[model samples]
Target: MEVDELDFLASSTLYRRKDFLETDEAAKSHPNRNYYYRKNADVDRLIEACTTKLKNNNDNTRALFIRASSYVKKGQLEEAIADYSKLLLVTPDDIDALYQRGTTYEKVGNVDSAIADFTTVLQLNPNHVKAAYARGACQNLKGDFIEAIEDYTVALERDSQRSVSSPKFHARKKDLQSAQAYGGNTSGVPQDAAKDNLGTVERGMSGLSLERQDSMLGQAGSSAAELRDSNGHFAAGSSAAEPRDITGTSASAPGASDPQGAEFYHARGFAHRKRNDYRAAIQDYTRAIELDPKHFKALFNRGFSHDKIGEYELAIKDYTQSLEVDPRNGYAFYNRGITHDRKGDYHKAVDDFSRAIEIDPKNADFYHNRGFSHRKKGNFSLAVSDYTTAIQLNPSHCRAYYNRAFSYDRMQKYHEAVADYTKALEIEPDNATAFHNRGSLYERIGRLQEALSDFGKAIELDPRSALSFNARGLLLERLGRIDEAASDFNRALSLEPNSATFLRNRGLCHRNRGSYQEAVRDFGQVLAQSPKDFATLSNRGYAHRKLGNYSEAIHDYGMAINLSPDSVRLYNNRGYCHAKLGRYADAIGDYSKVLELDPNNIHAHHNRGISSDKMGEFERAIKDFTAVLKLDPYNANAYFNRGSAYDSLGDFDKAILDYTRALDLDMAQGGDGSSQNAKQM
Candidate 1:
């Protein structure tokens, strides 16, 4: 194509200086031309010169470079790439060519190739600011903020004199703020890998960016009054005076007597916060507040720093002060609400979150946080309403959807919960928590296959998620995959050695497999971690009873009953243990307690009768047996026990009548009428 155009141009007189440089007189006579004909003539001349040169010597690298630059200026990126490619074939080590090609690739929207070319340019000249900035932009687009920040930092360090006015500095600062907010992972995962940690890390860790926080707090009167730093000391304005130490304040401190000094401290605090040094940030912000009591930004930023360090009371105080300084600070209220929620004061949290919503009615975070407080207070219906509002405000809010699902789960609305979880997963396909929780909901609704699939996906997405492993183990156990369940439980235990829940679940699996000794060992480990756990004590007692260790079983059951004195089931278990150990009187006492708590307990009545007969209390035995017969007319054992009691008391006639009724019931129940008790009667 280039050869043909060059041949035609060489043959035509259009390339003549007179014909090409001068505009046609006739066309010039016309009006409404958007561009000058002379400019078009010049472009034609440049193209003609390059093409003519290239056609004469097909290996002319200079002509190819000129033509590629012209094509780039004309928005013909593909033609430019071809020309640059030809030039690079001749001079592969040309840094300028690589850089120009990289920028052309960016214009053509081929970010990977652009990044590659820019990286090559950097390799040739490590201090190439344009290459660093261009590569950083590409990395940001690929969601590799950590690497982008590194590139931007290098560029900033290499060009610090231009840092204040450069867009690279501001872009780097913004990305750093966001990376800190989301806990930027430094583990070097692939740039294009699917993200599984979307919104799963800590929130509110980002407060401000040092160089670009003017929108949050309006700037001072003059450019010279902007926050400035020398060495590690921060100050405001052109004051060459030394910075006052944050450890102890002085009248000549950075924030002293200057309206913009508080901003200086605030900016420095943000720098500290970016390094995760919340304590130092708090000191800076506190100094800022001391300089200007009504500095709302400083007050709010201090509160955030305090919250980061788990000093909820101090955080609340700072937020309250900030609100007092600026009565319309919705963020102050919202942050205070979060602090209250962390402190377990749900009512206060709800009130503050409600106020925040009233001030900033359109913020989805306000509604979502309020809903979280409601859920904590067990108000599931209100939680659902808030979460719905949050979703309506921002339909793609996956965290809101996830929280709403939990609220639905608490209300026993399994279908609604499952749908919400599914919606969350739709918005964020790699949300492992959503997958794990939805699997639980599926299991609750008896969708076992769906539950299995979700659990499997959750484990795949987050291989180290102990909760997912434990939950899958429980589902597998329910499906009778005992070995698989045990394996998962072992994995979970290996990950979280002190997880009592995992220990208890594994113990239950052991009991189900009839490995009483192993079950006892696991339950004992759980008890060691949580000595007062009633369920673990009861489970261990059952294992001991299965192994015929009646004394140990009775002791465990006694401890469990002490923890939950009104538990009728605990009393029954203890009664059985006592009876197995030939402690008839103790067994009778436990059964009587069970009957006292539950007047219509048929099992308690029958067990008490058996204990009475064992203790030679014929009258009490007969009474209990009569009560059992009254409750269950077909109770053959009750009639037989009563006949034995009568015989023991020498009432032969009554004993014979009871014996006859017992024999008839035995025949009706498919039992052979050949009992030693009846024959003796």
Candidate 2:
């Protein structure tokens, strides 16, 4: 099977000519049209001729090989393999026959058999490039990663040697040296092989493609499509002392005259990429592009390498260039969107993702990534819609459910959020973020025990998650497990020493445990970092008040009030601090402000009543207390306080009536009639 005959076997052999009608009147009537037909021998006649040649000489190796190649071209792998086997019996040590048979086995998905044949070829000729490369691909298909890597290494070393020693390479090197005017120092310019961090798991936060499970051999060199003839015949080439093109086509043949050819550089670049030497790979891709600027695969793979190194902008440029050359490349758009998302240009990411979705409407990845971008932009409703479509397309898409749950959480749809998180867990049971987020949702809905269980599971799955520990600690504190909560908080703080949320949560636990000074210390640390943190300031004020540091407590409350003037609680707290310091007028003013903001605030009314009473304003105190009694009809404290105010004004009769009502209310509530102020009066 010579190349020309093989090429002809892969093309049409029949010829045709149009037949014309000879009626003069008809031809004159239809002058613009011609009606003629002619034909040559049938295409099957060519196949018949090849079969006749085989029938005449059944032992002819070329006839057997050509017939086998034709069978392969017609997708008859069994017949092709059989023919190759028969040819192999005649010439038992034929490398080409063995290589072709191996490739045929691969086409039929009999990878183990393919590997055996390739192994036999390597044993016969250890330096056989095609056999080694084919064997590596088979090993990779079989999930034998280590063996695949060894074969690829051998092929790459041979390829590199072949490239360096070629006469064309030396001439090109000299030309480069002359062009750059670098003198003769190009002799030993050391180039470092890039480190292989490609094995590191990607976060996939922006939906970038993650590391593939198989070894990287598949990314190198021509794919199966490029290796086959036009008629689908796979002609495996044998190398001479100088390497030949693996596809067995003279058009792609490597030679001394074409040192800077795109095919040569693309093969080398792919080899370097497989080894995770991305820097070296990029250089080769650049040279390939310099030779053939429209090389889309080289540009895309170079972008992928740049993305691995976190060079997002460079990756985007390469992807854009690749897309310009091949506008229908949806994957280029998808990856470019990922880079945009990583760069926090979420609007641009959305546009690119939309383009990808338009190009590849059935791809679930496009919808999922678009959903992620929508989520980042806080467009929760749009995010949920995209995620829903993705889930419908791929029922097992765990990340889609997880992200949808997050969007639900943002919308405060706790029940929906919990359901989505549960779905995500059903798909990926060990997803720690799903557990953590679900736990938080459970806690929000007051499912304390379930929240605790989820938090524990999250911690078990991801032991180093500081946020999980903090969440569990807060729940424990709420459940009155103060000692356990403190331990968890300590661990959380150790993991993330500067988290203000953790500090505030721990401080609350301390306050609940009556560790006032320790509570102050934690709150103070948070306040030091965020001086205008009203919540922390107010928390520290409460701690100070517990310690009876009235002045300090008052100052903290005033500072908190300045930061949040509209906060009802801050005003109430400041009022209490004023009352503690016997600043009755200031306390009354603070309470008035609280009342102005919330006119029906019962606590504010009661506190202001006390402040007025302290200043001997009995009439105003009685009115405020009366209002509290009206709002809360069974408020015994309010009745008793009003009674006391009446007594102070020497209205003993009304005071006695109010006190009687207070006693009646307390007895109705099954009380022992223990009214402190009433008894004092």
Candidate 3:
């Protein structure tokens, strides 16, 4: 190095060789002394050094081939094709030139031209494996499955291990196999039946097995058959073989072994999916995506796989990605909706379903699932609308009718509810729920015989239906058949375990049968589920009082009151329990609260009056008696209680008047009214 250059190299920021190489002194070394080369310590400057060598003299075929390869690498494919063609014209049977030109033709999507070039290479050297592989791909594209398979078999036989082992090597072999399984061309598939994978030999589909085509041909070669096309050129060199754009020159794909204007990876990926090889399918899909990132189908298929394998988050992301490319894809929306549903995000599921429906309203499944999401969210009205739309689109959709009926039943639109259930039954003759629900409506409307018949049908459809058995037990109990009610309740319990409502209802049957212990057990379980269940609490408290457990009864009554202090029936029962416990003041307090909430509660007033009289609250007793009388003027108990209250107050005239009134009302009804009046009081 020069002294000044060394000084500059030391002074001017020499982080590495580059710091020194960029100096004016380094630039002065040679015409091609690039800092980039200097930093690497290479005396050669690639292109510039080559120009120096060419300054001597050069017409070497090897050099020509090397330059052609360089041009090919630089995407100047036309220049590369010209160079290879000129070199081959001189060295006609040069295997390297032939192979290079063959591959280059294949790259340009001129598969027919490629096949001719490879044919010449194979003719000169019959064992050319690459030529065979390339010819196979071209043949496959041209709908010659037999020839393609033959070429592939030859290639595999000649070179079981590819010297130039590239992705194309494996890719071409796989596509050839697929072509053999299905038909050579895509359009050869028969959509009327099952399709073959590649097109070589067909397995049974739609009860027909296609005959396999002959693998290899004789010496004729396809070129002899190619020249008669409408384009007036050899089939391999025809416009169909090469992509002929609006411009005079043909457009070529730079990638090798793939077709010019066609997406071979996409076709191969679909082929793999058809063969149920998901991994290979994914590989091809990935390659297709690398080639064309916006391929929505590949994205969707990959996403669907993500869903099938419980990778829901990944599936959702992929579906979202597909939607970015194809905003109106209903299938993508529908699939995303499914993922959202799996995640239990009902609102998002519904929104996705809505968008999918907006894009393709004819899809009944989307509406049905959306309806289910709405039903889960407790939007029964909206659920009914979605379900109805599903039904309207597909009348034979049994689930839609059944779900709509459930919504109708919840809304208390009984007649419309019955119609929907009936429609569901018409579609599915053995529908047990339909019969059971219809029976419930019948029982509610006082049609006992019809209700029984429907219940019988339900039981026949589903012999183990707990709901049907429970309903029948309730009906039998109401009809004064206590023994029959107990048997049905027992059967219902056998069918259903740990059902709070079933337990509570069966407890009522037990109570009627005087099995108070069992009744209390059942009601206790129901109370476990809903700790504040006033009805079950009150019922169990009554059972306790009946069993002479007054203290326990009072405790239960207090719990019931805490839950529902405004329930008149609950208060009346609690007051009865308190009265049983001899806590007259407590009984009176509970009765007062019930009356305050329900001013016209007859039982509350009657019970409170009795409790007041017991506590020596004569005025309060008299007031309760008058309230009862207002509710029912003929109440004998009210008259009796008021007479007693008046006597206690030391008002003999009012007491005698009350006694007379009680006797007269009781007598005027001819003994039946007195018992009835006693019942009323």
lDDT of residue 251 for candidate 3: 13
lDDT of 2 by residue, 482-557 (tens): 9999989898889988977678778878988999999999998888888887777888999998899878898999
**Between the candidate structures 2 and 3, which one is better when assessed by TM-score?**
2
- Pairs of residues at least 3 apart in sequence or in different chains that clash in candidate 2: 18-36, 18-37, 19-36, 19-37, 20-36
The true-structure Cα RMSD of candidate 3 reads 22.4
**CA lDDT, candidate 1, residue 130:** 53
Error (Å) of candidate 2 at residue 200 is: 14
Task: Report the lDDT of model 1 for residue 554.
Answer: 90
Models ranked on TM-score: 2, 1, 3
lDDT of 1 at 67: 71
What TM-score fits each model? Answer: 0.57, 0.59, 0.52
**What ranges in model 1 sit over 4 Å off?**
1-268, 284-300, 316-337, 340-363, 373-386, 411-413, 480-483, 566-568, 595-605, 615-623, 642-664, 676-681
Which candidate would rank higher by lDDT, 1 or 2?
2
lDDT of 3 by residue, 1-681 (tens): 232432232122323333554564554555453333232222122223333333454433443454455455455567667767766766777776666666566656777877888899799977666567567666756656567656655765665555446785676566434322211111222221111121232211000001111111011112311211110110000000000000001111122223321234444444444444557656756776787787665676656555545677987887898789778776577667766766778799789879979998997766866786687577889989988998999898776776677677667786787788788789877866667767776776677777778877988888987767767777778778888877877887798777665687778778767899989899888888888877778889888878887787788888877876566777677678777667899888888888788888888888888888888989998998898889899977688778888988999999888878887887886654332222212
